[model samples]
Target chain A: MSSKSTTKRADALRSIEAIVQAAAECLGRNPDASLSEIARAAGVGRVTLYAHFASRAEVVDAAMSRALDRGNEVLNAVDLTGDPLLALERYIDAGWHLVDQAQALLAAAQRELPAGRIRELHAGPAARVEALVARGRAEGAFRTDLPIAWLINVLQAVMHSATEEIRAGRLNPERAASHITATVLAAFTPPGIPVPEPRGGA
Target chain B: MSSKSTTKRADALRSIEAIVQAAAECLGRNPDASLSEIARAAGVGRVTLYAHFASRAEVVDAAMSRALDRGNEVLNAVDLTGDPLLALERYIDAGWHLVDQAQALLAAAQRELPAGRIRELHAGPAARVEALVARGRAEGAFRTDLPIAWLINVLQAVMHSATEEIRAGRLNPERAASHITATVLAAFTPPGIPVPEPRGGA
Candidate 1:
C-alpha cells in the first residue's frame, strides 16, 4: 500500500508485460525459438525471466494467455449496441488484427494447449459471436438453418485463412483486412438478402 | 519388346508408386522424417529409394505430385453434367476426401516446396473450380459481385479450415465431408439464394 511498494509493483507488472510480448513475437516467428532467445528479445536477463516464468512451458502459457487476453479486449471493444451484422464485421476486423499479431502463438496454442483451456480462452469472443449470430437469425438478417456453432466456426475459419494468406504473401496486408471483412460478411449474410458491393467498386 | 522386358516395366511402375505412397505416409507422420525412414516404410532398400528419388527434395516433390494427381482424379470424377450446384457439392465431397488423405503431405509441401510449383500443382483444380463458379454465375445460381479468383480462394480456404477442424478432432470425419460441402457451397451461393437443406436436417 505504501508508495515504495506500489512503485515496485508497477515495475514488476511492466517487466512481465514486456516479457510476454517478446515471447509472443518470438514464438510467432519461430515456434521452436528457445527461452533464452525470448529473454534476449525481451531485453531481460535470464534471472529476470526465471523470476517471472518457472519454465519454458510457463512462458508459453503466459504468452498465449496474454495474447488471448488482448484478443478478448479487442473483441469487447467492438460495440455490441449497433446493428448485429455490423457488430459481427467489427468483431472480425479487430479479431484478425489480434490474429495477425499473435498467429504463431495462436497456432501453437491449438497444437500444444489443452482443448478445454483453448476453449476457455476463446469463450468470451465466442459468446459474443453466438449472441450476434442469434440476433441476426432472429431478425431474419442471417440464415436460420445453419447452427450458431457452425457459423461461429466458419467465421473463425475465414479469419485464420485470411491470416495465413497474408503471412504467406498471397494476400496484401494493406487491403486484406477489409477484404476479409467484406468476404466474411457476405458469407454470413443469409440467402434472399444481398450484401452491399465492395466499396470503391473493387 | 520381349515379355520379360514388359514385366520389368510394370514392376518398375509399381515400385515407383509404392515409394511415393510410403513417402507421403511417413511425411504425414513426421514432417522431418528421413529418406531412410521412407525407404524402409516402402519395404525397399536405400539403394532403391536413391534410384527412385535423387534427394529429399525430390521425394517431397514426388509425394506432392502424387497427391495432387490423386486429387485431380477425384475432381475429374465429379460428374459435372448434372445441376451445377450438385456438381459443385460432389466435387467438394470428393475433394475433401483427398485432402483428408494427403493433408500432412500437402502441408509439408507448402513449407518444403517452391511456391510456383505449389501453384502449378493446384492449377488444374483451381481452373475446374473457376469453371464451375462461372457456370453457376451464368445460371444465376451463384453470386456475381465477387471475382472468380477470390471465390476460388475462398473455396480453398474453407477446405483447409475443414481439414484443420477434422485433424483437431473438433469435427467428425464421417460428417465433416458433408459439413464442409454444405458450408463451402453456402459460401459460394449468392447472398439472395438459398442452398438446399442438408440431406438430413442438422
Candidate 2:
C-alpha cells in the first residue's frame, strides 16, 4: 500500500476502533444507551460521531466490525498444536481474554456483529482449527465422526460466554476459561482421553 | 406433601419468581437500578418487596435462586434422545428463549447472587448435563475427552449473551436462538454431524 493510502487506512482504523470501543462501553451500561453516550465515551463530538457513523445501527455495526477484527487477531495469535483439545483450550483462553479486555464493547458486538463479516473473518482460522481437530480425530486423539462444525461453534460460545461470566464476576477468569475448555473437551475428545484432574490436583 | 404445605410452597415460589423477574427487567435497563426500582417493577411496593427480599443483595440472590431453578428446569426438560446432538439442541432451545426474559437481572445476579447457593444449584444440573455429554462422547455422538464443567460454564454464556443480542435488536428472536443452538451444537457434535443447511434445507 502507498504511504498516503497506508496513512489514511491507519487513521481510519484507529478512529473506527475508538468509536466502536466507546460504543461498546456505552451500550454495556444499557443496550439502549444513546448515540450521545457513545459520542462522549469515544471522545468524539456529535459531528465527529456522525461523520464516522450514520446512525445507531451503523455505529453498532461498526463497533461489531472492530470487535470481530480483535477476535480474529486473537485467533491468529493463539498457538495450535496437533491436539485439538489442547489447541481449543488455548484458543478459548486467548479468545476470552480478548473479549474480556473489550467486554464493555464486545457485549454489544455479539448481537450486532454482522454474520457475513464474522463468517468471512472466521473462515480461514476456523478451517485451520477444524483441520487440527480433524487430524486429532483421525489419530483418535479426539472423537472420530464428530461434527467438526459443532465443536467450533461451541468453542466460540465458550470463549464469548466465559468472558461475560468473568466480567460479571460469576467466575474467576482462569477457572472460567478452564471450566469451558473442560466442558467442551468432555463432549468431544475420544473416549480414552482422561478427564483433566481438578486444578490443584484435588 | 400436604395440600396446605404444597400451596404455601407454591405461593413462596410464585411470589419469589415474580419479584425476581420484575427486578431483572429493571436491572437490564440500569446496572445500578436500586431495590426501589426492583420493587416498582415487581409491581409490589417497597414494603412488599422487602417482605419477600430483605435487601437488594437478597433480592438479587432470591432472583438468581429462581433463575437457577429455571436453568435446572431447562436441563431437566431436555429430551434425552439417542442422538446427542438433537437432545442437546432441545436443551439449548428451551434455555435460549428464557435468557432475555430477565437478562439484566441475570447480569446483576452474577454479582449479587449468593456464591454457596449458586454453586450448589450449579453442581447438580451441571453434572447431569455433563453425564449426558459424556455419554454422547462415549456413544460417538460428540467429541470425546473434553471437560464436563467447561461445557456447562460456556453453555451459560451463550444462553445469556444471546439474550443481549435479541434485546439489542441485532438478532431477531428466532434467528438468535437458531444461531446460538446451531453454533453450540457445532462445538460438541462429532465431525460427521453435518451443519444443518441454513433454513432447514431452504
How much lDDT does candidate 1 score? 0.76
Residue B46 alpha-carbon offset, candidate 2, angstroms: 27
Off by over 4 Å in 1: A1-17, A25-35, A46-58, A104-120, A190-202, B1-17, B26-37, B46-58, B107-117, B191-202
The candidate that achieves the highest TM-score relative to the unseen native structure: 1
RMSD of each: 4.7, 10.3
- Write the residue-wise lDDT of candidate 1 on A122-148 in tens digits: 787788888888888888877766656
Report the lDDT tens digits of candidate 2 across residue range A6-75: 9988877777777888876677566667888777887767887787787777887666566566667768
Report the Cα interface RMSD of each model, rounded to 1 decimal.
Answer: 3.3, 8.9
TM-score of chain A of each: 0.79, 0.71
DockQ of 2: 0.10
